[model samples]
Target: MRKTTFLLPIIVIVVAGLMSALFIVDEREKALVLQFGRVVAVKEDPGLAFKIPLIQEVVRYDDRILSRDVEPLEVTPLDDRRLVVDAFARFRIADVTQFRQAVGVGGVATAENRLDSILRAETREVLGSVTSKDILSSDRAALMLRIRNSAIFEARGLGLEIIDVRLKATDLPKQNLEATFERMRAEREREATDERARGHEAAQRVRALADRTVVELVSEAQREAEIIRGEADALRNNIFAEAFGKDPEFFEFYRSLTSYQRALKGSNSSMVMNPDSEFFNYLRSPSGGRAVTPPAPLPQAQVDAAEGAALEAAEADAAAGTAASEAQEEAETDVNNYEVDQVEDAEDGVQN
Candidate 1:
């Protein structure tokens, strides 16, 4: 009974010590064996891991991809524009031995903090060389790749592999948003003003060119009109000279008729002139010369009926014969009385 009791206690102690020295390494993690605060071995494969009992220790770190969100930081670009950048990273422990040696007993926590500093530095260095537009553009993927590659080299010293780095957001700082908008507005306004001025200048040039062309066209037209009018007047005068040279007498007759027409235009036309005036030469003769002749009077009235010329002549002769007989009888009686008185006067003279 006493021997079984002693072996049971000893076996329990041995099992407990073995259990304390053994640790499980999942496929998702890696292990490091440390002794006296120094890394002596690494277990990268998943399995039961062992260490010196009561003297060595095991440190485990995730072997799978891990993620970390970086605190937002400000970067000044080549354009002198400042941006606030939020970034993150995916990483894994590449070498557990090197990781354990670098981070010591602090394990994954310590490694993460150091890795963050490396990524931040690389982010600032890479982004500082580019403009803010590039960081905020579709080509941002390329920029992130550059950051990752640089971070990878830096993190390698700490036994960390940087799988990828990404920028979550890139924006201007809050205090600068309104100022940036105002600047953009000013730039656009200036460009618009320049365009308007150029357009106005072009319009003015076109208008002046058109006005000059119009003036030239009008002047040319007026010159042509004046030349044509002078030619027509010369043709008209030539025609008049030819007609006058053809028949001067006929021309004079036509001119006289025209003058008569003008002088006697209306029934109320009146003029004071001598009867033998040369203006009345045409009235004196149809041939229109100085010859003159009296015109016989024209009978104005005619009997409608019963006007026999022989009967009217006989009645007029009968009335004249009656008046002549009466006068002859009176003369005969006076002559007889006068002869009687003369005889009586002769007798009286003889008596005296």
Candidate 2:
């Protein structure tokens, strides 16, 4: 029982020692074996690893890519504008030995703190040389690249390979937003005012051109109309002269008759003129004036026939005149009898 107890305790102690000596390094981890607080071995590959129990220790670091989210940092750009910047960095340990030497027992946390400082310092240095507008411009990729390069250079001593550094966001402080918005609003208003002025000027120019076009068209139309009227008057005068040349007496007589017809057309037509006015010369004598030439004499047979016709017409006219006289006398007699009847009725009424 004593031997069994001693063997049992020895086996337990040996098993515990073995457990303490054996270590594991995963594919995602890098391990450092330290003895007396001094690094003795680095295990980068995955699988089982051995360490001196009680004399050595294993410190594992993630070998995979890691990210560091920096706190919001306030920076002032060359434009003297204050902005809050949020950034992140992607990095990995490039030299495990150098990493251990640089960041002793603090491990990943120490490395991260150092990386954060480097990122902040580099970011401020790069950003401080440029205006905020450039940071916000399409050149943002170049700016980020510059910041990354600068951070990488500074972090070289920290045994870190800075894969990339990025600005998550850049924002102006609340105190400056109102001023920025007011300035933007004023600039837009000025542009709008210029546009409106240009529009008004263009409108005025169009109106002037339209007015000029209208005046030109009206003047041209009036000139054409006057030319047409002059031609028409000339034609009328030529036609009148030709007619007069053919037969002066007949033309004058016809013209006088046309005038008389026009003057006497309306029932209320009246004119104040001398009895012997030239307008009535044709009426006074059908041949017109002193220059009137009588018509050619007719043949004897025609004259005889005309005289017989005239005699029959005169007899017909005498008979018609006599009938008209008798009708008038009868109308007068009827009117006298009606008046007498009216007078008799009045006398009888008075007597009654």
List TM-score per model, in order. Answer: 0.53, 0.61
Candidate lDDT scores, in order, read: 0.74, 0.77
Worst 10 residues of 1 by lDDT: 297-306
Instruction: Put down candidate 2 lDDT per residue, 158-273, tens digits, no spaces.
Output: 88899988889999888888998889877766665665555556555655555555555555555555555455555545555654666766666667778888898788488888
The model with the greatest TM-score is 2
Segments in model 1 whose C-alpha atoms lie over 4 Å from true places: 185-352
lDDT of 1 at 70: 89
Cα lDDT tens digits for candidate 1, 233-252: 55545554555556565556
